[model samples]
Target: MAKLTIVASIKVKSDQVDFVKSQLENLVPITREEAGCVQYDLHQDNENPAHFLFFEIWESRELWQDHTNNDHIKAYQAATEGMVEEFVLHELTHIA
Candidate 1:
């Protein structure tokens, strides 16, 4: 099976950018240690601090689904509640 690629974009409230960034940073170490996580990277827009993106590669969609259901993910959701202005995620196929 083809590996799963995920592109997630997040926009935080103007006033909560720093706090949101810290929370996002906290997730990286933990997520990178999860099963099937080939790569997990986080990026912030240079000009727009409130904009954040995650580029992730997983061994399979099922494993990625497991990741979404993990306790850490749930905690992230709860911690950032109301601070996120917009959230978008895409699952992609590596066509090459």
Candidate 2:
């Protein structure tokens, strides 16, 4: 199976940045602990703190799917409900 690359951008409400960032940071260590997780990084935009990014790599699409269904992931979805103003997901493959 081919490895997977995910780039997700989350635009949170300007006033909710700290709470959103805390919630986002909670996902990192847990996701990193998952099997087949190559990398799961969180980044905040220097210019716009309300904009956050997730750069993830998984061993396969299946593993990435597993992550999406995980309980923590579910909780994240619940916790961030409405706090997120916009979200974009991109699934990718490395050429280099």
Candidate 3:
């Protein structure tokens, strides 16, 4: 199967950036432990502190679905609920 990529852009509330980052850090271990995760990284925009991006690569769409329903991920979603300004998710297929 071709690799699946998920790009998520998040805009966080000003004072919530630090807390949101901390929560994202907790996701690292969980993502790494997942069966089909290839890469899962979080990045902060250098010029815009409120901007955050999640770059994720999975072995298959099924794996990505699993990640979405995982308990830790659910917790992360709940935790960030009110602290986010905007959240956009993009799913992609590898071309190379």
Candidate 4:
């Protein structure tokens, strides 16, 4: 079995950056505690306050899917509804 890595890129409305960041911050600890979560880190772009990224490593794709279905993640989606301008998820298949 191979571990899966995911990078979630998000851009929030300029005015809502701080609020959205706070919401994202709350998910970090909770997500890190989930089963098969090898690493879950949140990062904000140094120059673009509205841009946020999440780097996650999971034991398997199924486990990562489970994490996405968790309650806190749902809450995050609900809370940030229209505040998010763009949300893109990329699954990285590390080569080398």
Output the number of the TM-score-best candidate: 1
Candidate 2 lDDT, 1-96, residue by residue in tens: 568999999999998999989999999999999999999999999999999999999999998999999999999999889999999999999767
* Candidate 3 local lDDT, 1-96, one digit each (tens): 799999999999999999999998899988988999999998999999889999999999998998899999899999999999999999999998
State the displacement of the C-alpha of residue 82, model 3, in Å, after optimal TM-score superposition.
0.7
Candidate 1 positional error at 30, Å: 0.6
Candidate 4, 1-96: lDDT as tens digits:
778999999999999998999999999999989999999999999999899999999999999999999999999999999999999999986556
lDDT for 54 in candidate 3 is 94
Clashes of each: 0, 0, 0, 0
Per-prediction TM-score: 0.98, 0.96, 0.95, 0.97
**Best-first order by TM-score:** 1, 4, 2, 3
Output the TM-score of candidate 2. Answer: 0.96
Give the per-residue lDDT digits (tens) of candidate 1, residues 1-96: 899999999999999999999999999999999999999999999999999999999999999999999998999999999999999999998879
Candidate 4: list runs displaced more than 4 Å. none
Candidate 4: RMSD over Cα atoms?
Answer: 0.7
On a 0 to 100 scale, what is the lDDT of residue 28 in model 2?
Answer: 97
lDDT on C-alpha atoms for all candidate structures: 0.97, 0.95, 0.93, 0.94
In model 2, the Cα lDDT at residue 55 comes to 98
Error of model 3, residue 90, in angstroms? 0.8
How big is the positional error of residue 27 in model 1, measured in Å on the Cα after superposition? 0.6
In model 3, where is the ten-residue run with the lowest total lDDT? 24-33
RMSD of each: 0.5, 0.8, 0.8, 0.7
Candidate 4, 4: how far from true, in Å?
A: 0.4
